[model samples]
Target: MTYALHQGDALRVLASLPDASVDAVITDPPYNSGGRTAKERTSKTARAKYTSADAQHELADFPGENKDQHAYGYWLSLLLSEAYRVTREGGALLVFTDWRQSATTGDALQAGGWLWRGILPWHKPQARPQKGRFTQNCEFIYWGSKGAIDGDRNPVYLPGLYSASQPSGKSRVHITQKPVGVMRELTKICIPGGTILDFCAGSGSTGVAALLEGRNFVGIEATAHYAAIAEQRLRETQDGLAREAETRTT
Candidate 1:
């Protein structure tokens, strides 16, 4: 397994990638659903918006969480357009977003020239309940394919929904880190040994999962702090894989 982590603006970095270079684009970009008003969006930090008052961890806030709803749509479309160019025909894209931004994300996916497929929900089992309304426990994955999808190429039945909780305790490095187990299963969207791109790599859970699943990875992170953390995590994953291989051969 191999992986590359680039630290820069995702939109700019994506433009530099070669066309048809990756088999899948699996990313958890910032949902930007924190604040409704422009003033709130600009003023509130990511940690202030997303975290509860008594939240234990002190993870640093990431950028791009301040985009207003209208700006978010345009920004996402441009980023997705570059992503589409780098994905081969029949390749898939999976973007993570909350209910507030799901519809706009779908529109952006199509605007990027991808053939919209369907939604895949990720249900958090431990989500807090609201007495007056339904629990806001589910985040959605809007998936699409570059042109027509050829199931024959990566023939495998995958689940329609995923059940996983956010990373916790010492394992939680990023403010919005996804579970590695969920990412490992999601990486199956790509063919074995094929490369996957995650422009908003964060703490690199996506790349770590790809390497663990026998796939290659190309990750881009905007925050230097998270990029360094991602680099360390990727290196640790590679070292762990090498140890396992050596143990088997020994």
Candidate 2:
């Protein structure tokens, strides 16, 4: 189990990697909500109702969040293209996006030469309800393969919808950090013992899951602060796994 975390722009870092270097790409990039829309959606009242005071201020401030639709689409396409280049043939790419950008993300995935598989819905059972509106309780995971996928035929198959509660405030290192269980589930579907790449690693939840599952991980975070946090979290994850193995051996 190996892991490396780099502090740099995801696009630049991804471009530097060699072709077919990674076995899988699993990441949660910015939703590119144009800042204003995201701010409007998170009204003060809603924040107070949903998150604690400390958690409210810790919301992520990452690059590309304020991009207009056109720019966001272009940026997403470029990133996906790099992902496709680095991923081994038949490797999978799983990216998380919100409803507003799901269509664009899917289109970008196809544009990047990835074989469009399908959307995986992540159901957050504890999602907050809005008055006079349907609850926004799910996020979409865009799954695609770099080329033809080769895998064993499973008599029983997993469903497209994955039900898991969102990460609690206490466990969140990044504002949009995905639940560890969600990352683990996605990782399990990839080739065993293969390397996982996350260019927009945020707080490194994906790396933690990969290491815990005995897979190699390469993560790139744009901000030094978040990169440091991710490194610490990954170190802790490795330590925990080592302890578990030692205990089991004894």
Candidate 3:
């Protein structure tokens, strides 16, 4: 029902938050992937890696995509460790990653003191087809818990596979914005009214979804451009909720 968005380094902001403060951490950090070779993956900017050459949108690029595989693993482990400290016991972690970084993400989750649970595939229907190979149309979400998950607390049966398309045209604010429909479903993992933290909250998709789902949100964005965009989206979501509440009350 409420949200707090911090514009700064995610690690630094997370450190300032109290331990056992949040109920879940659902984040989609940069994959640091796009090419098979190290040079291609490390050298290219986020816009160059994720966006096509002829893409119509003039969306701003994001950071944290330059790290090589080894560096990425270490950085992710540190972030997850910080997130684990912020989460209460039995709280959950759901992180978005591509096939190239799935193994590393799982390793980092365990390294961060979380119990590895399972992987959820997010199928993108609009993905372009490839020839002579399996079409890489799916992204993965690695989910786990701080400890043993007490299902009795928040007993909502979530699906294993999520299918959604990326936002396009005017609705797309971030280069890698997840669909609000998908995000709303993902937000249900947390208990009703519980707080969710998204460290890499580009354009506030996760925070907006969390608030609309009757949950509290705490977000951290590093880039000022995306932070301002995120703040605007979060405010609009809150205003819509407030209007809805007022309508029912009156």
Candidate 4:
């Protein structure tokens, strides 16, 4: 199976891969923020409203809805179908979503026949606050398994309320850039030395985490610019790890 970056559409690239090809799936799909409405895409003018506050400017300009539950589900269904096809039985799928879409997305996964394992709340204490709304300081990761649980040996542990600080400065590189600590923690649950797949690999934080934890990674991105940035980040991570290994050996 292919184990490198493919500079193409995620859906098309995933479709080309064989069934049950990947060991685990960990991704951060679009929150549908840049889209105009749940049903329709954003116009050019509307897309221009992106501010420097976004982690990635191009991603902020992505034409999709942050609240299009139905349409988002449809899109996710295709990805999930492909993800399921490429994931082996007893494999894991870790999906990251904000409070706005977690429940709906989780329900969709259940309907798609994946076993709902549990939810891991990634508490970011330094998240931005809304003027009139409650401060959303956490993003929940819904974990799903391909088949039934194995036994007591594979008991799932609840990752206690982790209180990692979010990135303080604004970044146009990737809007929803997760902390390295969070991704690193998630990688520890899965078996070591297996391949990991991430489709919505914004700035490649997941890829960095995978490499640092001694696992090979394959990331897919739709935007050429973001994909290139992700590739660069992955390369940097690999290089950093190699350096660390050399230091230890010396």
lDDT of each: 0.94, 0.82, 0.95, 0.72
After superposition, candidate 2 runs with Cα above 4 Å error = 34-60, 153-156
The candidate scoring highest on lDDT is 3
Candidate 4 CA-lDDT value: 0.72
Per-residue lDDT tens digits of candidate 2, residues 1-250?
A: 8898989998889988999999999999877652236454333332233344555455545554656667778888999999999998888899998888888998899988899999999999987799999998899999999878777621225578888886765686666778888798788766778899998998899999999887899999998878998999999999998899999999
Location of the lowest summed lDDT over 10 successive residues in candidate 2: 41-50
* Candidate 3 segments exceeding 4 Å error: none
Residues 207-234, model 1: lDDT tens digits? 9999999999999999999999999999
| Order of candidate numbers by TM-score, starting with the best | 3, 1, 2, 4
Residue pairs in clash, model 3 = none
Instruction: State the lDDT at 211 in candidate 3.
Output: 97
Error of 3 at 172 (Å): 0.8
* Residue 120 miss distance in model 2 (angstroms): 0.5
Per-residue C-alpha lDDT of model 4 across residues 1-250, encoded as one tens digit per residue? 1136776677899988888777788888876543345434333222443334453434544434344567777788778778888887877888887776776778767765688888888887766799999886787888898896454534546474566775445533565577888788787655677678898787788888888887778888777777788888788778877788899999
Instruction: Point to the candidate with the largest TM-score.
Output: 3
lDDT of 3 by residue, 1-250 (tens): 8899999998899999999999999999999999879999999999999998889989999999999999999999999999999999999999999999988999999999999999999999999898888888999999999999999999999999999989999999888999999999999999999999999999999999999999999999999999999999999999999999999999
